[model samples]
Target chain A: MRLTSWGNLSLDDYQTFFYDFNPNLLAKIPKPVIAVGASRSYGDVGLNHLGSNLLTTNLNRFINLDGNLVTAQAGINFAELEKVLNLHKLSLPVRPGTSYLTLGGAVANDIHGKNHHLQGSFGCHIKSMRIWRSDSGVIEISTQREPDLFFATIGGIGLTGLIIDVTFEATEFLGNQIKVENLVFSNLSEFNQINQSSQNYETSVSWVNISGKKNGNGIYSRGNTVPEFAKKITKAPISYPKNLKLNFINSTSIKIFNNLYQNLQKSIKISLVPAGKYYFPLDGVNNWNQVYGAKGFYQYQSVVPEKNAYEVTEEMLNLMKEEKTYSFLTVLKSFGDKSSGGLLSFPMAGLTFAIDLQNQGEATLKLMNQFDQIIQRAGGRVYLAKDARMSREFFESSYPNYEKFNSLRDPYFSSDLSRRLLGF
Target chain B: MSKILVIGSTSGIANEAIKIWLEQGNHIHLYARNHDKLKMQVADLEIRFPGHKIDAFTFEANNLSKTLDQISLDNFDIALITVGELKYSDELVGQIQVSEKLINSNIQIPLAFAQTILEKYKTQGYGKLGIIGSVAGDRGRGKNYLYGASKAFWETYLEGARQEIWKNKNISLSLIKPGPTNTAMVQGRELGNLRLAKPEAVAKVIVNGMERGKSVIYAPKIFQLIMFIFKIMPIKIFNRLSF
Candidate 1:
């Protein structure tokens, strides 16, 4: 069977297996497998190109929920978890840009969102997890118990083992309402300053325009949860029309969209919005990625240190302008000093930016390679979860601890990313 | 808050009705043949609606009499019967054993369970009973005569029961005849020409009919007109028709 992740950049044939509710049925699948959860990763991180992918989407179930903790099967995604948690006035501490990612996928990717400046990545909030190892039997690991395996598995990209269930701590919220403030920014420096001044808010992000006309103009937004007593408690159905898929995101269309988006947000000051609208705006239109035409698109995300943040981002934006490249969405977020225990966790005390560009064959690949060089010069690293093509040497140089992680990886478990980087 | 019992709870129709009742802060007991799926579904329901009480049991609906005896029902206010089986293969038309099993699953089992529940509710003098019937039962078609025959039997049975039970103002029985609905039972069948009703929409009709003390309901509303036309059609014309 052929499968493509969220990026839709590449589709490769894979051997997929489903493990139902029966526990004994899991042991029947062949070894050398990569456990896939929702297959939300942009690249081949969730796909085992050489072997089979043991799909865990069907194993979704709520195990338990205590005072401030939630235990759910790994197959459960944030979309399902958020619905259940909202009923109890609780919310996830660190949610990614998209809520469709599975719990296991979040752990494997160690995803971070606009709130990363405070709560760190998703792995930082996990209390404990259970995994079915190929070398060993079923095992429960945590930061205190099996620290080595736990840390390795936390952004291990499913190379460690098959994660069965996860127990994580969640935050109690007033309601699903959020007070948002959007401010127009002039350049990269202004965006950084705005992000720094908005430390009091729960979430902060910047939307940039990278086309030729208004290249550096953007809007910086900050949001905080509405107070319990003041919240309106408006519940709207999260339905996306199936007919909204439009393959109109070519060079011409994106340029028009970029201008319109910048103009729309240039005047907005403050408003109250739903948590879903504030956190996952792309979710408003289902399969929003299909707008990038039949060939799909690629996301290039890189994080540079505080000192090189302004210069590195400016250079990359200038390069895109010089190349006459077009990207529909260019998002920027700042990371906090609080690091995750995951051995290969992506976030650091730096500035991260993600740009979505349509895949135009060799031209797209060449442009990405150039961006990689610029990022490497600024001592920045690419996020593996969002990467479709990054050199193996660059990956090794960026993550110096890869050797230790490789040694702990399950002998029978492998993925396309691991095969590309570690020559497995 | 009413306590409800849902039979064949794993079916799409039963699940949608369960969600509506749970959202209203009602307690529900789910019964299905697959224990593992039932447990997972029950846990999911509990998580989705924390304040409501939810429980699950594993037993075949074909033997509902033996199954119901094992479950407790002290203060149950409503019962929903959504158990059914569909056989569409042309190969099974002349097979006597297969047809008999289909009759048992679609007619005998549900009828027996409905009769037992109606008797118990008749004594209680204040309860709601909901049974699912298909619009295909309106007129026998050559394509799916076995399924049509079973549901046609249920319509007659329900009509007679409604006459006997409707004298009591407190007791209500709903006969829901849903049109072509999107479900696993009709997976491979073409539905381009027929208006496909969502299971959620059909489930709502069933629940609403029971709430309004309605004895008969044709889901999607248009099915009522379609069925009326079928009922009035001449025997000569109906016999010659394929559908």
Candidate 2:
């Protein structure tokens, strides 16, 4: 079967095997097996070129849901988890941008969301996990027991082992709606000022227009949980549509869409929205990535320290303008001083900018390489979850702790990302 | 609330049917081969519908009779069977082995198990039993005779059983003949011109047919007409047509 990342880049042919919650099946599988859950990663991190992928979607099941802690098989996506949690009036401490990702996928990537400044990445909420190592038998790893392996498995990108079940803490919420307030920012400087002032809000994010016309113009939004006394909120029906055919997106159409979006932001300055609508806007459109066309697109995200964030972001935006290249979606968010624990985790105290540009083949690759150079000089690293073409030299330079993470990886567990970056 | 028993509970179509039944506040007893997966599914249902009662048992489809003997059929309102596999081979010897496995899984186990439930339901004078049949059974093909033969056997057996069960007016049976459905069992195989139905879509037809007391119905409704023409085609002309 053919497998591709969310970015629709790096297509690789691979055979997949399914396990029905049986651990012994691991021994029968070929060596160098990579476990795939949802394949939500935007790059080759989830694709194994040398061996088959063990699909964990069938292994989804809840082990337990006691009080605030929910223990479930790694195959269950947050959408299902959230459905159950809503009945108990609880929510995941750190919800990813999309709930389509399986629990194991979220852990492997140590995903972060709009509330990263307050809640940290997904790995922080993970209390323990049961892993099936290729050589070693099934064993439980947690912050206390086998801490090093547990830490490595969390953002280790499935290089550690197959995560069977995970136990994590859930936060209690009043309702599943957010009262949002949108503010328009003329430049990156004003966006930073608003972000600093809105420290009390539970969620904060901005969408910037990198095109030459709009330049730094964007919408900055902050939201908090809707209070109980507020008028009853209606949840929009959740639907997943089939991916649209190619040729759905082009540069001209995107420019018009961005302009319309900017204009709409001015009208909808304040409104109440469902949590799903606010947290996972992309989930509503299902296969929305196909809009980028058959060649797909690349999402380049990097986090630079607070001191150099402004200069680095300005230089990157200026480069895009100079090249007359524009990104369809430009997200700018701030990270807190939370420790992700995983050695290769991407979040840190800094300003992170994630931009999605349609793939123009070699030109797109060349532009990403140039962006990597700027990020490297700023002492920052690209997010592994969103990277499709980061160089090995830059990967090593960005993640200096690669040696430590590599030392703990399962001998037989590897991915295309590891093969390209670590020569595994 | 209806008391439903679903065999091969983890199969694609069965799972979807189970979800709809559970959503309607029915109490379900599930039986499948994978113990842990069934437990997870049961837990998921219990969480989603806390008011309804849900239980699960793990049993190999080939040995379903033995497992059914252990569980009492008393108080069950309906039983749905969705257990079978596709097997193929060009060599006669290999084909025989595949045929035997298919017969054991698709015909013997389901018939024996359903007979046991029907015997009990007949005495009680009120109950429903649904057996999943296949359109492939309408005619044997050079490509998948092994699988088609087993389904043909099951459909024939149900046709005979329906006559006896109808003697007791309150007892009901449904022979659900679903067309080519997109499922893991059919993965990689060329489905030819047959419209591939989604599992959920097929499940809806099965449940709705059971509610309407449909004895022998082709799922998707359109397949009924298609199969009507297919069944009338003379053997000489049918054998010449290739999927």
Candidate 3:
């Protein structure tokens, strides 16, 4: 088996099987240890396991679309998947923060898109899957054949078995561009009220420009839904990312980077845009991690319930301010809802703030540790996906119902991503 | 039937080995730099296997005195030191300070822990000790020879400590020399097609070697044979293929 990473990977150790296997042809190997998706599914949930040969690059064929039922190999990417779905005038229900995941990966991680509350998780729409169980060997499962494994496989972290191909129902899209409106929240609390007050919109997420400050802190959000008056355009739309550059700098660098960025943003006017443009604003700048420089960066994304938002975010911001750590990317989004079956699923009708911390040495860990304490006190758990390193105890303490999650996990079907983070 | 204390819980091998102890319903104490990541693990074990007691503590495992004091209450039957330094970038190749820290982190600190813990285990009349040594320790090669030197010293120290104490006292010490296990430590680094063992495979070998009362184990079994061949090769020829 061969192994290669996505440069330094979006996070780290994004293990993907570097083989090509056609469903038409049989295997000389065990289906790439278990195929890993586009790797956008944070954590090692999408990583290949030990002694397991993976088929990643080769399994990315997206062939044939029968109505809303799209059939794809394990490696078909989400961006391309979205493009195909849009071609059929449809969209996946829950889109995780990124659209780079494979259909198999999205199912494995059960990714939740921006409009989670209205739709539930990504697994809600999945009809069935063609799986190759290491123990039972290949079988097609849905709500019937091996239904326990199927339900468990939904957010199973790809542990139930290897997914060779997937077929899920898709939501129809209105037009190329969603009618988007920009709502700049002066603070987190304001974002909360506005987010809660509105629900009729098709999609909503707050883009927080949180820099560890009280005022002028929070998101520059964009909410969009299909409008009846919108004209249908035949041409495919393009999205330019706001740039996911978490610029790491000393005091000198911080001032220059923030000043230039803020000034540039002061002029961008409100307008309707493509759904991709509205959602993945930072997708344009390729290798956006370069902004953090050679030291690399840490993306800290945590979900805190609305009740604890004030106290928690206050302490969170206060701690970062005290630490004097500057990050170019800090986003606050009000989560919608989630399914009951999702064991370790994020968001319980709360606000999640994601920030990128450039490696500023021990200080970053200390601040995160401090953030961990506040989050723990305020009843919040850190997101396992974006986390490269976190104490196992803290992870367990936050996730008290892990016994429930662990019970669902197939003994042989443990995720490499969760295993590494937990050091198991 | 041994309740053990795994000092360096972050080791890939140690983590898998701990699972066996958990399965045996043995009380295992997990220690590492980060506590949150392991809470889910130890907690689940504690809850799932109610009889299996798992306690975790976050400490600078490199600090012998601090670790010894913190773990005083838990009189462990085994002390497995899996902490070591593995650096891939050339940024630390020649830097004496960096090398010194690596040696201290991998060798000196573990040495201190061994000296303190082994004395207690010896006095107690029974103990098992395993270290996650590497094939790099089998002999110095061009790549990461400094790390090899540290592991080599550890292997020698463990051998001496084992010999100094009478074998009949029921003390067992095993040096785990796994060739190159597929671990996060070697994720993106270049390790030129050596037979890399899996973490579980390494753990299984270590557990078996401990059960058989073997002193040193080359993980995956094949690496032992491979290293045996490498050990006797002439220095001139070995040096040619060092890297």
Native contacts retained, all candidates in order: 0.24, 0.18, 0.00
Cα lDDT tens digits for candidate 1, A1-424: 5667878776666666655344444456555678888877777788776766776765567888888799999887898898788777788888887888889999988989889988999898899999877667778999887899999989888888788889999998666778889998887777877877998888998888876355577888999887743444445545534345557776788889888887878767898877877887766666777666557788888998888788888888988888888887898888888887788888888999899888888998999999889888888899999887899988888887899999888887888888898767
Report the lDDT of model 2 for residue A341. Answer: 93
Model 2: per-residue lDDT, tens digit, B1-243?
A: 898999888787888799889888888889888786677677766766666778888887645556767655466889998877877646345456667777887887777678788877877788888998788888788877777788888676777877776678777788888887655565433333345676778889999999878888688789999899989999999899966
Q: After superposing the true interface residues, what Cα RMSD does each candidate give?
A: 8.6, 5.8, 15.5
Q: What's model 3's lDDT at A59? A: 55
What is the CAPRI rating of model 3's predicted complex? incorrect
Write the number of the candidate with greater TM-score, choosing between 2 and 3: 2
Give candidate 3 misplaced runs (Cα > 4 Å).
Answer: A1-34, A41-50, A53-55, A212-216, A226-256, A259-269, A407-416, A420-424, B1-243
Write model 3 residue lDDT over A120-191, tens digit each, in one string.
777878788887665556779888776766776776666666677777888777666666656656776676
Most accurate candidate by DockQ: 2
- The candidate maximizing TM-score is 2
- Ranking, DockQ, top scorer first: 2, 1, 3
Minimal lDDT window, size 10, model 3 chain A: A1-10
Candidate 2, position A351, lDDT: 92
